[model samples]
Target: MSSTPGLSTTKQFRNLLLSDQLEFICEAHNGLSAKIVQEAGFKGIWASGLSISAQFGVRDNNEASWTQVLETLEFMSDATTIPILLDGDTGYGNFNNMQRLVRKLEQRKIAAVCIEDKLFPKTNSFIKGDAQPMADMHEFCGKIKAGKDAQSDPNFSIIARVESFICGWGLAEALRRAEAYRQAGADGILIHSALAVPDEILAFKQEWGNRCPVVIVPTKYYATPTDVFRQHNFSIVIWANHLLRSSVTAMQKTARTLKEQEHLLSIEDKVAPVSEIFRLQNAAELQEAEDRYLPRGAEDTCAIVLAASRGSELGELTEHQPKTMVKIQGTPILTHIADAYNAVGIKDIVVVRGYKKETVNLPNLTYVDNDEYAETGELASLLKALQSRKGRAQHTIVSYGDVLFNKYIPQSLCQESDDCVIFIDSNWREQSRYSRLGGFAECSIPNSRRAFNAKVYLKQLGNKIPESNTHGVWMGFLKVSPAAATLITTIITELLAQPGNRKATIPQLLQELLKRQQPIRVLYTVGHWLDINNLEDVVQAGEF
Candidate 1:
């Protein structure tokens, strides 16, 4: 995507190499780093061999296989629009290996490769600068020719890295190797050095005299000014390994601080927020793609929140506002639930309001009034919402307004394909404090230690289920398919026909569905939800 409209990535990279002005590139070892490099306004990427090897926890001695390095290059290529020049150490083998490497690089859309004239399993230049031996000149030239012939793209480049200076063979051998590689069809030359100054590079440039484009990696001589490279007319300067090194320093500090403090309080402001990570990962793009390509049913799922009851157990908290309006961390409980629903693409929300109805207003919600609030329970409110909507949604979510849960709960529930699916908190035993709050469930498989993917059906669900018979507690959230929505409307209409059943609850309605063999499935989660029942619950919700 970053490539010029008409030019290919290989051409873009070749242009940088042959440009009249000095060009700069930064190193990136992974997809994320490659994106970061692109974000920082770099024109190209130097996929550093040392950095890539270090990322895999291996020494930069070809310890990571060629295929493994190619896999990383694929990700980097996909993540950014810029050309990548890979540090292909010794072409990973001989002339045949060089040929294969070039074809694979083209497949991954890599722009160029810079292979050192050193033996296979080459040591890092800085590791022991003078100890490593250079490859035979004729054989290395043949490898360069093989790579050049193998490339399918005309602009795909091969920059021969001369190691004569690194091997203490000095400037004469470096120029000789450079000339031979250029004659063998190398697109450019990368004259490598590990000296603390640019004396050798400057001498090589002066004598080489515009024979071809030249590249320099000034890692050791970083203190030298950038203007020097520009003044000397070098083709490109690579700031290799700094990004990886800087990340290492930052991660080390963050890890040590976290281990010592045991909390994120001190370091929260010092690091990138989770939202920043989402932005860098281009999460919004995926959402847009889903909107364009996914089914309408997935996007059109509706939510009906039952918030009609006055939570008397909260004492004075519900005296002025409904329990769902109680603020936790400055956001109302109902707002949190609404946000969760919207996050999972459930935009058409209907809130059934009753107690302190005038105080229950929120943005972007259709309100259905349950005027007989004092005379009824959750079932009556649900009935009001359903009758108002007239069974329009293909899939509908029913939830209690006072419950606060992680967004993943609703995200997971939306993926269920069953006609009726009930969410049960299997960690109910650990959450004994909520046992008295009701909606205990009894499933066909009573044991909580079943296989993770085991199919379990709800046999009974109500406040009256005995503790010994209940497998878990319902989190007051359920999804209903179109058929189940129709079935529920019929059942609720029949039940509410009797005036005395006006005070019925949602759990009781679920019990009736089970008795009629409605085949409701259970979706079990551990603990990631809470309900506000009493004043103690208010305190816990704040912390939740």
Candidate 2:
């Protein structure tokens, strides 16, 4: 554990941070530190919140100066070869400021950033002698939309961090925020450390992971192996602040080593080899993967729903804003979808706008303004959307913008041979506290042979099972094949083409599919599925 009083520029460190092999982050405390980290054989640099907050010499509040953050980001960008993910303290302010902050950061070529639910400079609720209130949920969601709207590259990762669990809020509250952030357009949910590593990992896996991919910092939380995380379907796992941990650990140990060992030479054996470190930094030629398939995605065929913080799920929470404007746990739900899709590779996306559109700014995402949005359902809003694809996905995904769920629905349904597939959860029950307060309820359906064409159990619409099990509407996710999408479009277009004819909702479209005998499949998602529709639910959605 020897150092020139700093992190080493060794091949091993480079390999860990660079090569995109591990999600380990080398944290840069300041602009000067950013350069040191990069030169010290690191691939990516993390701008930390706690460290940076301490620099301000004031308690963390939701009121840090933007100038400090902006300048620091600029400084970090200048010192690194790898991308720097800034810790955007609540986007440095409200919706407008948040937009500007993200744009400025993206312009700097920083690869990623995080927006926590903590009001910028917010004191931790869990930290003894540091209890404070956070930003209102609605305001925070707007901040999330603002950040997403401001980014140019859809791949530029935006992590929505939820701090409720760590800050004195209960578990139910935390889960509710996780659901909201997923719905709000966040690329992922960044849950903070509740305690030491193992307990934190257990919390993450148990709490709404099926809704989205969970990102974690092992240094502060659980110190489990990667394989354990992979088992729970965590798409991206970052061992955040490890470089910081190592740096400090080395200093402490080396000081003791020198004091205990009469000869400095005895302490030298603990150091990692220098030559191995340079190799990881690629001091030689960078090998090109000539045969590796250029990563391709099926973005060409689909509907891009330009989303806004919409509906009543936010209620008074969004009275001054939109539902997408409210914070889930810590981040807005809107940011969850943006990060989740971009991470796994769904780049071409459309976001239909209604409610408050000015609060969000995103590039490569087609925004369709819904003029009659208040009078129409998602199908009507979708009907107003414009597709860039020549033909829709043979498997088109009709995603609900305001409802937060995971991004894995596409992959799960893609492999299915069924002409039509719907991602469904058996938890489709009557409205719970979160949903009822959110103002949206899962649509009910008769659970019988009719829902599924079963030789094991078949019955006509009128012929019901004597003791049937009933499952209500979904958690708001769909993976429609092109044929099914086209059919739904045709069916709706034909119906709506006639004045006074009602457009078919997603459920209606499927009901018709049942009558038409189209083969349909449902992938079970018994995880958290809250229909976020109001302010009460905005804070309550997935407690169930």
Candidate 3:
């Protein structure tokens, strides 16, 4: 549960109900949607029962159990500081159940609950409007009384949802029930109507005289202007279920379009970006907490960028600087790589520089000179970097400096719990920029039964792998766990000692590891990376 420093959530909700000006709340079905509602400036949340049940793919008729609703409430309460008024359908049962629910809701810091005057396993008010019978007024009043008695917090609210109008009961019965509920200790009365106008609600308000604060759900009559509710001095107006409705519309459209087109090119820009999701999930907070609380050894993840080559294929672009230093959209590819690493909390970045090594400069980086870079390959530069670090890194990310990738690639790779994991582009065959020269990987087929734990192993990794046997092209990025780092350091040291392997590349090193029966997992991605291998590649990378 979350709260403001000076005011409790219950008290805040009570204030909203009793305030002179009208207050509004939007409906949310889950934690993420609840937080979004709060972020949208709503002072409170209406945890709509219909929306919650729909989210579970169940009917609004209490097909989802009370415990399930409580669990969802827990998440909604924890995700936001705003008060939540849960639509507790018929209090889940009688007075005993209402009492227990009140206790549990108070424990979870939910501000209030609105239980409609209907039988247990209630149907939605808008559905079969005149057919659903309202619960006995005296019995529901007792339920409200029990809930008020059970609440330990003084300000916890119990709003009685009067469904008399929906049941075709006259305004007189609605007023009578409202007065009885007020006498029975309900904090507010939420008068519901299925009419296309606010006439019934206004008529009830005119006679009831706001004996207790009146709440309104004009969901059926949304065409009515807000000023009408304010004119009648309605305390709260609930825009219930719109968020879930809008989300359903969006998801359906996106799903249908993607299914028809069999691709995301048309729909990608219409939806939220992955980074937006990370932001809403507060992922940076967890990363900050990990940095502060995780063990020093566990946090000791570093990056080794094999950036020694001049990328002569890029023509005059590398005349004065290394290929990794070439500007892409006004930023160096190495800087972009470093930024990607930094985004995932890899601060200990080491760049292996050789050609124009003096020209490569970046803040907060530890440079390792690979003077033999002109004669050696990526494996030799990696060897030099590993030898300099002396295998202290708990996890190491080795990436080609000229490649630019989405931050999610490294973020996803770091989550793998394997000895060694390589990023592979499964859509490699469709890419015109890639050729036989790029490193290809052959991975064991993933188990179809265990979707969550379906691990794909690297059966072979090298440029020499036949295209027919290859699963994907390696993206020149890989992560090594502590044991894998030690094993790699040892293997590279021994291989370099036998000078014949001096110019071995990263794929060659991976192939050697595979030959020794080392288990290397594969993290498959489609294509969110750019490999700047030539002048055309450089132009494409500029747009990346």
RMSD of 3: 15.1
User: Residues 1-544, candidate 1, lDDT per residue (tens digit)?
Assistant: 3456677789999999989999999999999999999989888999999999999999999999999999999999999999999999999999999999999999999999999999988999998879999999999999999999999999999999999999999999999999999999999999988999999999999999899999999999888999999988899999999999999999999999999999999999999999999998899999888868765344757889999888888878788998889888888889999998888778889999999999999999999999999988777888888888774756888988888888787777677778888888877777656643457888888645673668889987766778788788888888898788888988988898898898877777788888898899898888889877787777888778
The TM-score, computed over Cα atoms with residue i paired to residue i, of candidate 1 is: 0.64
lDDT of 2 by residue, 212-281 (tens): 5566666554557777765666544554545555666887898888888767686667775676555544
Best by lDDT: 1
Off by over 4 Å in 2: 1-22, 31-43, 53-64, 124-126, 242-544
Clashing pairs in 1: none
lDDT of 3 by residue, 230-334 (tens): 999999999999999999999999999988999999999999999999988899999988777754332467889989999999878899999999988898889
- Give the CA lDDT, 0 to 100, for residue 19 in model 3: 94
Q: Which stretches of candidate 1 lie over 4 Å from their true place?
A: 297-302, 305-371, 374-544
Q: Rate the local accuracy (lDDT) of all candidates.
A: 0.89, 0.58, 0.88
**Candidates sorted on lDDT, descending:** 1, 3, 2
TM-score of each: 0.64, 0.40, 0.61
Error of 2 at 19 (Å): 13
Q: After superposition, how far is residue 187 of candidate 3 from its true place, in Å?
A: 0.5
